[model samples]
Target: MTAVQGLEGKMMNKYGYGTDYYGYRKKFVVLVPSTNTAVESEYHLMKPTGVALATRACVIPSIKVTNEEEFVGLVKAIGDATEQGLKDALSCEPDHVIFGYSAETFWDGKERSDREFKRYNDIAQAVGGCNITFGAQAIQDALACYPGVKKIAVISPYMPVGDNMVIKFLEDIGYEVTAIKGHCSPGAVEIAHEPFGKTRELVQAVNSADCDLILQAGTNLHFAELAGSLEAELGKPVLAINTITFWHALRTNGIPDRIKGFGSLLSEH
Candidate 1:
């Protein structure tokens, strides 16, 4: 083998990681919004053998976000609760962290996203050298797997303001957002209550002939399975935020599991 390939083979383990039994392959700490109810279960569904996941929710008030002001407050509340959430999650001594919230990562575009990732990394380093993976960066990495992808359609459980932020981040990274649809879910918890049919409706609304891919945001929204199913019917790739983030976490941590049924992002790429 080449020298680099030899080094990689030494690093990639054949058994569980760290000191856990269940998380024998890898131990992952996932942080989500306190009011969210979908992310943990979705992560479990996509979880591979010899992997373990512990979810910590960043506490936030379960209130309606009808306007931009309340939406901003919701964002602030998640921010206020995040540091403590990370500290609590670190007690498990996981190998990696998946920050389940997507808004902050896409808030001010790529520069701010990079800064926030570094900050989360610093916190993880303080405890035991674990690193963090965020949705915006993960989605970017997932998209890069398809070289011809240029225009994309987006769906999010966010307000118009929040969708604009997602658009800003995608555009900053040189992807053309062909269309976007935001659910404006009444509250944070309500995002989990969103029905599965909404995904098909949103996809139909935003997808165009020229669209190269369809990406769904909102970790709390249950769309992972739907993404895989839709790809078969749409004849293009559909990426769910949770799957992309978890996939990124798994691959970057030296877990080369080519899990199927979660779209080509996981199964093929």
Candidate 2:
């Protein structure tokens, strides 16, 4: 369903809006890369009432790699594959389309990320003939829910260089990104396999007193499980890309701002 319809539908479900004759169900379709198992599950859990969400997996054609050159190529290629996925998603006549993954858009820099996001939309418009949202763009929208949060601490499973790129992007956009902690995994594929238990440990390790909020950067990393609990433990906002992306997509479609038991940010927004 479109964000507006999604929100209205949810409100109607709880408060009863148009009860004339069982109004049409809202449908949201996501195009997720095969490697990204975390996003779909998170979206499903966070999905509001009356929103029927579906996923169409895109072939990776390869596993995640950390080698700089290969990483660059894979990221670009994923965008290409994702465009095709969007085309397929359009076949379902979804109200809106979501890229369903992060990092790929920010592979370059601030300008690069912006360009890539626009590029995705343009490509999707040309191929799928519909508008779509990227994870990075979703984060930007989600941040609006929490005003005056300038200092952010990033937790990631990327290598130091990859981490550096993300920090730079945030800094360019005005966030301090005061601290960062990454395993600098041997490779991107290794990051995909990084144990969720260990990821929780890293998040705990990097969280600091200076930051007002914590951000988990990669969509592929397992983060949904800790979102609610971590916010309660830290007493600070914690936003994972997966969570923020879905939140933004729903918001853009006009979904009401109430999604409880997910995170404090959702509660306050």
Query: For each candidate, C-alpha RMSD in Å?
Result: 5.3, 5.4
lDDT of 1 by residue, 1-269 (tens): 34455445546755634456556567899898888878899899888776789888777789798988888788788878988899888988889999998887898899998888888889999885889998888988999999999999999899998999999999999999999998898888888988989768988999999999999998888998999999999999999999999899999999887887889999987
| Overall local distance difference test of candidate 2 | 0.72
lDDT of 2 by residue, 165-202 (tens): 88878887778887888865554345566787787788
What are the Cα lDDT values of the candidates?
0.87, 0.72
Q: Which ten residues in a row have the lowest lDDT in candidate 2?
A: 17-26
Sequence-dependent TM-score of model 2: 0.82
Best by lDDT: 1
Q: If scored against the real structure, what TM-score would every candidate get?
A: 0.92, 0.82
What is the lDDT for 206 in model 2? 77
TM-score (C-alpha) between model 1 and the true structure: 0.92
